[model samples]
Target: MDTSFLDSLSDSDFDLDLHLIMGKKSSQKKFATMLDSDDTDSMSSSTSSMRLDNMTENGLSEVQVGKDDLLDQCLDALYEKRGSTREKALASIIESFNSSLQNEFVETKFATLLQQCLNSIKKGSAKEVALASHAIGLLAVTVGPGEKAQEILEESLSPISDALRIRPETSKILSLLQCLAVITFVGGEDPEQTEKSMHIMWQVARPKLGANVAAFKPSPAVIAMMVSSWSFLLTTVNGWALNPKSWQESILYFSTLLDKDDRALRIAAGEALALIFEIGNLDKFCGENKDSSEPTIDEGKDSRKLMYLHGLRTKILGQVRGLSAEAGGKGSAKKDLNSQRNTFRDILDFLEDGYTPETSMKIGGDPLNTSSWTQLIQLNFLKHFLGGGFVKHMQENQFLHDVFGFTPKKKLLSGTEQRMSGSEKRMYKSPNSALSKARTQLLNKQRTLAQGRNAGHFAVDE
Candidate 1:
């Protein structure tokens, strides 16, 4: 095994997200306090300065300006003839997006931003194309599961496909794969739409070219990415709606990937298989399409399919058992080895005991929980895809809130906001505050009644 390739596997696992272009994180505070508040125009100047300071630290010092203005500048830059200029503009836009939710900006400029990004995909350099891909994905996330999301999917598919046809660099391919997964996950209104995107992704891993066309075999990294991205979109699809024969073939194909030398490829295949089993329609995925009331076309054919599925399951179980206890090989990355072991172990546990993995995490004072592989995969994929903005969306994005069934306790307060004094805190219930006014009126009416009963009774006269 090539050590460099093995090392690449370790780094490529979750590198599909925007962390590549966003660069290293500097100590930064979120600027958008209005995320929790209704008034968008009420951000204090001090907090605005803090936001600018963070962006300056990220090397956007010269472009320190209001969010809308910065976005406008980026939009204008996208139209510039230079690829480097467009790349910087796309990077700035991605930074702005990952730092905060740009709902208002997206609402007004959604089409324009998307069209520009797609143009970049069609014309820009590989780096620019990757950045453009990341920007569009963030756009889908910001819009989040509605008409706008669907429109994004519709518009992005063609240009992205055209880009993929050229077989760009590994980074560009990874970015485009993730972008496809994200847009489809949010915008795919039905299973068919989701499956269409999956088909596009799957072709990268298993391409079929004409006799004269040069064959483009995917490296392990690309294959792993294809599997991971395909599985991410798979979580949104309904198993019943899938083609039975195709999935059975997929099961066979993924099982083969488990034996590959790349640890990341094995881990991704393991997760994909685990999700398939978790869906628990083995009969459907194994090529049995007849309803219970319908007569069997051929008993022998059905039986053979069942037997074939059982053999595949048994083979996979044995393979998973070996991987769960795999010893580290020479030249193998310890981290990658352990990750493979852990993942396969989880898959083995689920296959044998019928128990899915459960996990929990804090998302802005709210518990985002997942008790199944499907939910966990969805959560982790989106987290990596959103990167810094995960918390922002998890906290304030209603679409995500609905998807995850998460409701935050309260909006997060900014660092610049001052703590209230005891008297000021009490004033929230002191009848002067707007929230307490109605309750105060009710209390005043009650006080009037109570005074009559106790009138002149201070000395026990009553």
Candidate 2:
């Protein structure tokens, strides 16, 4: 609601600053040759005139500084010992990260800023955790090519690894995982790097899948992030990643999850499986290995992959049949069963119809077989959650009792946490927040009751 910040920008050339930060050259004759020899000397002279007497390491006072000098001032303010000043600096720096060239410039002191935030998580206030988490996620998504990104990986590993092992609060853990996801896929173009990152993430996250600790249970939102990250990696890197043994482990774990009570988790896992089929080269992997030295494809590593896909395929049949059978029964049991049928219906709908790769935007470099597997996932979502026809004769031949054992149906809110969402938070400052409004309503109600009691006494006096 305050326009006071705009006053500070009155003298700031935002457009020019952006152009200079991004290193864009203007073709106009007036500034055609950006920062020419003469301009460089003029910039140096102007920068030299700016006094630092009022500037502190923790804060920056508005002053006339050359374009070159502005970057230095922003850095000083960013690293300010004062938290508020540092937050302001972080905001400025985060915005500049939009430009890759400028992002590299910010990376000049990246380690320091990252360390400051990473350290904050240990003892910082809730507000501090929120800010630091956001900042870390931003840097993770940006950063540099292999070298700079590698530096971030090395430096950030300790803090993140500790956080994961320690199993901190839900918020902290989510933030940490989010940062991991972003960093791992820094440039989705590079399959090798992407594959390595996915491996690292799986190494860290797999432990939490059925972790003995209470904090490790993947919530709906967390599962969404985890599976989606895997899906993104699969889509980005293509099916080459499927060559690893971990692929089966990942797919096997997710296939069992198809029958999970949490519709969201089931959907995430299911969609992740679909994405794997679409991008993970199921045909090459289906009951076939390139090395002929091994036995038949079914007996090899692809054996389990095939079995898992078959298990998920048959599991879908039983699930829909069970739903139909249960819904046909009488009484309250029938009603509850019908409710479940609807939930299961939603989970199966995409598999039944929604998997359409033909309609999906095509990325270059994808193999033709990728579309075949994708079509298979859509046409026979139940046939092969990932990919099938590797052993078509084995369809519904085996019981899925082991792969998808019984999980007690949880009430919709059974495992839910107690935190309110951020829906009420608005962009601009409000005269009263939701909390303030609630308090005001309570105070007014109390006042009305008191007035009623006083009015009754006056009537008695009359």
Q: Residue-wise lDDT of candidate 2 within 1-462, one digit each (tens)?
A: 898887678445787688675642222211212112132211110012112322322122223443334444445554444554444434344433322224434447667667776766555543345446556655544342345555666566566666656755556565566565555534233556566656655644566445564545556656655665555555434455345444645655676665555545555565565454334344332332344234454655556655545655555545544543443433345554555565445334434443333323211222112222222222232122111221221111111111112111221122232123345522221222333234324433442333333222111111
**Runs with alpha carbons beyond 4 Å of true place in candidate 1:** 1-64, 287-296, 411-462
lDDT of 1 by residue, 1-462 (tens): 668866766555657455644432221112121121232222210112123344445444533456787687667678777666566667768878878888778878999999999999999888888889999998988777667888999999988877887898988898899999999977777778888888889889887678865688888989998999998887765566776545546777888999999998999988988877765556654543335335567768767876776678788888999999999788999998888888888888777765567799987657888767777787878887887678987887656665566667763242113253333431011112232233323433432333333222111111
TM-score of predicted structure 2: 0.47
Candidate 2 regions with alpha-carbon error over 4 angstroms: 1-92, 95-130, 140-146, 187-196, 203-205, 208-215, 261-264, 281-308, 316-462
Worst 10 residues of 1 by lDDT: 27-36
TM-score of 1: 0.74
Please count the clashing residue pairs in each candidate, in the order shown.
Answer: 0, 0
